[model samples]
Each structure stands twice: as structure tokens, then as C-alpha cells.
Target: MADDSDLEKTEPASGRRLEQAREEGQVPQSRELATFILLIVGVTALYVLGRWGGHRLMHMLRTGLSFERAQAFDATGMIIALYDVAMEGLMTVAPLLIALVMATLVAPFVMGGWVFSTNILRFDLSRLNPMQGLGRMFSTHGLAELVKASLKAAVVGGVGTWVVWRERDHLFGLMLQPLEASMDEFASLVLFATLLIISSLALLAAIDVPYQLWEYHRKLRMSKEELRQESKEQEGDPQIKARIRAAQREMSRKRMMAQVPKADVVVTNPTHYAVALKYDPEKSGAPVVVAKGMDIMAQSIRELAKEHGVPILEAPPLARALYANCELDQQIPAALYTVVAEVMAWVFQLNHWIAEGGLPPEQPGSLAVPPGLDPAAGDPEAAR
Candidate 1:
């Protein structure tokens, strides 16, 4: 059942999922790759400095063995002599230790890069569950690890055996030779054997790196249901989003209605559409549509305009055109400039007449908007 579930995860993991996994300290790493790098550094360091180290060791050994008789008799002198030998040994090995440390630092970069997540440090009780442990031990991943280990051991062991067997006669002859010459020959043989083992590891590392990356991504794959759930979590619930949109629209409507009382004139379809126009000689050369609405919203705008003593003009074509084409707080289109100019002239006239108490100024006649500008241009009922 578990295997079937794993197979069912056909979708690739998303970027967010991968980032979450990284934050949790879960990353693809091949032990073989790290081992290969460290060993390579070790072999290079040894190859370059081996002869110098060997000579140093020999000199130190000779000095320690040839200590003065008086110094050997004195405990303080003997202690100082022992310390000198230890210092010499430490100096001879310091280069190798440094090389190994540098290799350790660089090895992680070749795979998962450097990760400093603290999650891995936290203790988990699941790690102590014997049933889970047993399941992991028998899992396919565990079997693959076992196979890789066995193969590595076989390759290294086979190469070592071959080197020893091939150098069998030379090995016996070395014991009969002078110690110094024998030591050099032994060092060469050992270096040769080490290089062969490292070569085998190179092959294993090459294979393991790709396998580890593949396994990492495969484990992170999402099921269809999981993908849908993640998408929903990211985008939010549709019903809640709709409610938010509805509230936004309501607030926008209220704001539009508030601007109606400040309009210079309210052009209306008389019953269906209303668009409030405002003109500011200093701010804009042309009239701007301050508020517009249809049906119940139009009724509200008309009632609000009447309450504030703003003029209401019945111009079906102009109202429909302005309502359909013009956005709030934006100047009317250039194509309807001539008709809107006449309406503005009439508005100036009306304001003067009301202030000076003369006969009411005649409203503009047939304010004809451009063709295609009116939403209901061809409808006979809209024209009426």
C-alpha cells in the first residue's frame, strides 16, 4: 500500500515545497561523493609531502633515540626531550590535517551546498521507534544503500588484493634489501594501491551523485490531491475571495454616491442611467465624470443630486455614452467634446440665472454624442 501511494505521487514538487524541505534540513547528499573528495585531497597531500614527512620522522626518531646519557638521567631533561619529539610529530602531520579540514568544508558544496538548519538538532521520538527503524532498514532506500556499500567494499578490496598479489615477489625482496631502500619501495607501493582504491571510489561517486538527486526529487513528488490543496492554500478560498470582492464593490459604490452631490450637473437616462459631471476651469479644461451608475444606483445618485440642488438634465444618448465610455474622475472623450462643451455652456448659464434671479437659462438642445459611443445607440427605446 505504501509503495502504491509513492507511485501515485506523479506531480513534481513545487518551488515552495522544495524551499520548505531545505529549511527543514532535508537535502540530497551522497556519502560516497564526500568520501571521494576527502580521500582525493588526502591522497594529493600525501603524494606531494610524503617524502618530506618521512625524512622528518626519521630525523626525529634518530634524535629521540640518541638522547644524551646525562639528559636521560635527569627527569626534567627527559621530559623536555619527550616534548621535543611530540612537537616534531605534530609539525610533520599538521599539513595533512589542514588539507583534510579544508576538504571537509568544501565537500558539501558539491552536493546540497552549505545548510545551517537547526531543525536537524531537535530530538524526535520517532527516531527511537523500533518498528519504524525496522521498516526503514528493510525499505528500498536501505537496500540500495546496502548494495552500494557492498559494491564499494568489493571494489576497494579487489584492487588491494590485486596490488598485493602483483607485488608479491617485490614485497618479499624488500625485506632482504637495506631498510632505507625498502622503505622507499614500500611507500611507492602503498601510494599506488591507494590511488587504485580512490579510482574505484570515483566511479562509485559518479553513479551515486545522480542517484541521490533522483531519489531526493522522487520522494518530494506531490500527489494530485496534495497539489490541489497546496494551490488552494496559496490562492485562498474562492468563496472568501468573492465576499471580499463584493465588499470592495460596495465601498466603491458608496464613495461614488458621495461625489454625486458635488457634481455640477447630473446627466440621466431619466430612469435607467445617471452620470454626474463636474467641471473645474482651473483643474480641467473638459468636464470629468465624477459618478455614474445604472438602475437602483442611478436612482440613488439622482435623488442625492436633487437633494443637493444640482441640475438634472434628461439626455438619454449622452448619459448612456458617458456611462459606458467614461471612467470616474476622468475627462470625457475627445470625440464627444463638442456635445459636452454645449452642456457645460448651459451649466454656466443656469448657475448665473439662479444667482441673479433672471428667467431660467434654456438647457442645451439635443446634445448629440458620437456614434458607437452610446452603449444603446441603435435601440429605439433608448433613443426615446
Candidate 2:
């Protein structure tokens, strides 16, 4: 019972599942629909061509039966008559044959579009396994097929018997009537039976179409675990992806540290943030940020600056603003021109005083950093 439940297809198929099934050439097709179409086409073709065919058939019979004096003893004459009879028979049924062939060719495409695959034609050795074949024959699907076939056979037989009983008088009188009249009545009876059978088949086809579609979808249903596995396969494992991201950040941090010693000065938020800037009048008009970091990385940048003898200035607002707005290797914003120029002048003056071995000009007392440029709001020193 547990095995049976496990085999049951409960969940709807995903788009990938449906596509895979279609590639394998497993698609919904109603055999009853094809049968109905072929029957209707055959009956209709006969109805349209019956009169013309009857005339030709009669002419052939007459020629084949007629005796000529010149051909009375000629064996070649008999051969000629036979050839004429064969040609007339071929012409007589040509339209019906063509109609049946066309119906057979077209019926499947109307259900599942045009899908031709060599996969289905390939022979598998497993198909010859006696136990498996027997199991399949007695399977639920196989039993359902057997039931459907039986019902169809019964319906067709019943209709045929009823039609024949109603036309019994015509059949019995065929021998008494002229050949042409008998043939006409026989044709009419056969056409009537065909129409009845086709109508019944159409009804069966209507029921079978939806059933086949349902069965097709059921066969393709996937379990929850299967869906999860497929999704993981497509997107990759999340843990591995997170590790990759961490490794990338580590490499970027190392590169940022490498550029810190090259910067002319380091701006800091005391202990939290650090931004390194480099200025060269010959190369660029404005100072460019060479590196920036927060917390642990900020500490590393400050240590590298001190070790390399680079100046470190405590400017919380400038440090935070540069870290927030400027990427490494990018120029600072134009709005910070005045404040940054003030800081640079102070650094240059201090450098000149130390180089000349004497007191130099007094540096600017305070920089006028922009109001909203501060990352930390309500800092009086940043705004001033």
C-alpha cells in the first residue's frame, strides 16, 4: 500500500519537467479522436465520389464481359480484359484510399502538434523482459486501456447490428433487383453505417481528449524533494556562494591596505573610520582617495600610515564623508574643495617650517566643512 502511494503522482509538473517529457516524445494523444476523424473522412469521401465511381465500375464490367468475334480464340484478348478490370478497380477506390491515408497522417498532429522523434522507434532490450511485460499488461493503466477498448468494440458492434437489422429488407431484395439498383442500395446502407459509427466515435473522442491530457500531466508530476533538488542544481549551493563572497571581500581588503602607504595623508573618525587621500598638482586637479575602511580595516590603514611616516589627521566628518561617498582610487567631490584645500595648506606649511629649520607662517585654525557632508549628524566641529 505504501509503495502504491509512493508511485502516485500528486504534484503538478514544472515547466522544465514538461519540456523534458516533450523532448522524450511522451505527449498526450487521443487514439479515439484519430479513429473518428479517419472514419468521417472515409465516409464523406465515398459519399462525394460514389456516383462517378459507380459509372466507371459499370463500364469496366461491361467491357470485361463483352465477347468479340476477333478475340474469341485469342488468349491475349483475355489478358487485355483483365488489365482493363484492374485499372478500373484502381481508379474506382483511389479517392477513398487517398482520403484514409491523409486522415491517418493528419490526426496525430491536430492533438500534439508535429512531433517526430526517432527515440520512440529505437528498440530496447528491457522491453523483451517477460516479467516486466507481464506486469505492465496487468497494470492499472493497461487495465484501463482494456476497458476502453471493450467499450468501444461493444458500441460499434451494437450500432452495426442495429443498422443491419433495419436494412435487412434491402439486403434480401438485392438479388431480385437490377445490378445497378442493388449496388446503389448497398452503397447507401454502408454509408449510413459509417456515419453512425463515426458519430459514436466523435462522442468517445470528446471524453477521451480530456482524459488523455489528465493522464499525461499525472505521469509528469514531481515530488517536493525533486523540485528542491532541481532548484539547487540551477542556483548552486548557498553556503558555497557565501564563502566565495567572503573570500572576494578579503582580497579587496588586502588590496585596500596595499594602497594606504602610498596616500599622502590619512583622515580618521578617531577610531572608527579612515580615508587615505593623495594629491599631485602635476597629474590631477583634485585630491584622489587612495583607500578607505571601517573598524578593523580602518585600524590596519592607520597603522600602515604611521609605519610609512604618512600624516594622520583626526577629522571625523571628513573621514566619514569620504568613506561614504568616495570609492578607492576616485577623486573627492567638488563640494569639499575649500575644506580639503585648507587641510592641504596646513600640511604644506607644517612641512615647510620643518624643512627650513625655522618657524613658518601660522596654519589655518579651522576648516569650514560642509553642513550635510558629515555622515554623523549634529557634530558641531564637522559643520564649523
Candidate 3:
């Protein structure tokens, strides 16, 4: 049995899926993972550099503050102050935030490439009905949204638990340390924790990017109905193509019939084959095959020849040879020149004897050649 999903064709998401995901809160989670990774790497590098610089400065400040001289205490005052410490912290951390913002801006391209289709933005008036919209809101996609939310919660909870467990000892140790020392240690620990979290989120994003791309391509696959529609748009209807072919054949038949009147003689396989030949003394020494056909086209050619009063001779071998070897408006082969010349000579003699009021000469044998004609002289057309 076919599954229900298989029975109904799956339509593409048409950009709407991304928009829907945004409305359902998935977009932020997706971006968060990418941003988190960038933030972690940036902060980690900055923290190490800042700590090294701050440590040296703090040591100098302490040594200077230890002196009883008024000038030394004044010189060290700003470096050891809480406000200055806070400002330094901001300077060190700002790059991490900037990196996170940059990653967020680039995340969509890394994950989905540059698809700028506006298909999802169009709204149907019918869908504006409150009841229909509400129904769709609570549909199968709504269930998917719930599942995604649950998965996100689980991931965050699991990671949070692990972080807490790993940092428990250091966190507890912070309470026993002096105020300034504890603050310094707390800042470093917080930066490290942030880095670890960002790394985990980035890894998750890397896996998801490929999955999203594959899913997008799968959604774009054409359904059977869509393929059918596209084919119709490209090729038109089969019935129309057949009608056009029929019209073209009719036009060709008329043109071939028109050429038959100009032909000198018609050769036929009695009923099945017909070929019309034409010869011009100045233009062609050998006869040219004007038209030839078999079956219905043959019948049409014979009808046209009778209408034009052209002589039709029953010659099976000649008709078959002309039909098989000759194309319209092409001169006959040199090998058949003797046989064709004899036939044409007979035709001319019959016409001449009829005009002069005498009986025509008898039909000649295939081996007979006219006087003054050389069998090996080659066709006059070939000489030209």
C-alpha cells in the first residue's frame, strides 16, 4: 500500500518555510549556534592577551602603590581603581561581541547560500480568513515547531548541567579568595565558560547547515503534476502536433501535383509506383526525375499526369529504380541513360508518326540503342 504522503504530491516550500521557521523561533536558535562559536574563539584569544597585559600592569601598580611617596601613589591610583578595571574589561570583551555580530550576519549564507526568491512573501486573500489561518497555525507544522522547541530545551539543559558540574570546584574556591583576586579569577573563569559554550553551539550549527541545505533541495523537487504542466507548456498538445503534420503533408502533395504538368513522361509499376521525368535539351542532356512516390502518393501522381495529358508508360523496373535512387528535381543515373533514351525516342516517334498520319514503330528491346548514340560516351549531363 502507498503511504498517504506518497499518494499526495509534496509541494515545494517556496521560501515560506524560512519565514515560518523565523516566526516559530527556529531562526534565532540557528543563528545563535554560529554566533556562539565565533564569540568563543574571539573571546578566548582576546582574554589570553588581555590577561597577560593586565597582569604586568597590575604588578607594576602594586609595586608602585607600596612606596610611601605621594607621587608614586598618585601615579598608580587610576590603574588600581574599580572603574578603570571595568573599562579595561569592556575593551577586552568588545571584540567578542563584534565577532558574534559578524558571524550572525554571515550565518544564513554559510547555511543556505544566496537564495533571494520572493515567492513566500505573497499572501492569498483566501488565507486571510481567521478560521483558516488559525487551523493552519495548529497544523502538522505546529507539531514540528513543538518538537523543535523540545529538542532545543534538551540541548541547552544538558550543556548547562555539564558546565555547572565542571566549574563547581572553581566556583566554590572563589568564595575563599580575596576580593580583587577573586574578581580576576571570576572574570577569567566566565570567559572560559563562555568560550566552551560557544564552541559546542558552533559544532551543532556546522552539522545543521548541511542538513538544512539538503532539506531545501528535497523540498524543491518537482511533483508529477508540475512536471506534466511544464511539459505541456514547452511542447503544446499532441493532437495539435498531429494536425500541423497533416496540413504540411497536404501542402507538399499539392506542390508535387503542380510539378507533374511540366514533366516530359511518367513511368509506373502499373498501379503501385509512379515517377515523373523531365528533360531539357539546353539545360539537361539526361532526363531529370521531377517526382516519384509509392502507394497513395503514387496514385496522386498518376491522376495528376492523366489530368495534364502526359504519357504514362508501364515499366516496373524503371519505376522502382527511379523511386529508390532518385530524389525530386535530380538528373537520372548515367547507367540507365540508354534505356531512358530509347523510351524517349519511342515517345517522340509515336508523336511524330501520329502527326504525319502513319503507324508508330514497335516498342524496342532493353538491349537496343539508337543510331549515332555511343553507350560508353557518358551522359551529356555528366559532360556539362
Clashes of 1: 0
Kindly list the per-residue Cα lDDT of model 3 for residues 1-384, writing each as its tens digit. 223554454665434445654454333234445555566556755675665655655654565345455644575564566455566656655666676677666656654433444544656786789987887678654564565556556666776677679888988999999856876887777666666556666666676556555554454445567666655666876788899999998887778778898887888876677899988989987899888888788888898899987878777666766776678888887777878887788778866876896777776455333333332234443222
Q: What tens-digit string does per-residue lDDT give for candidate 1 at 1-384?
A: 988999899999998899999999889999999999999999899888977988888888888899777887899888989999999999998999999999999899889987888999998999999999999998989999999999988988898899999999999999999866888899999889998888889999999999999999999999998988888899977888999999999999888888998899999998789999998989998889999998898899999999999999999999999999999999999998899888888988999998998899888888888778988988888765
- The candidate, 1 or 3, that scores higher on lDDT is 1
Residue 126, candidate 2: C-alpha displacement in angstroms:
1.5
Taken over the whole model, the C-alpha lDDT of each candidate is 0.91, 0.83, 0.67
Find the candidate with the highest lDDT and give its number. 1
**Top-down TM-score ranking:** 1, 2, 3
lDDT of 3 at 153: 63
In model 3, the worst 10-residue window by lDDT is: 375-384
Number of the candidate with higher lDDT, 1 or 2: 1
Clash number for every model?
0, 0, 0
**Structural RMSD, model 2:** 4.1
Lowest summed lDDT window (length 10), candidate 1: 375-384
Candidate 2, pairs of clashing residues: none
For candidate 1, give the lDDT.
Answer: 0.91
lDDT of 3 at 26: 38
Residue 145 alpha-carbon offset, candidate 2, angstroms: 0.9
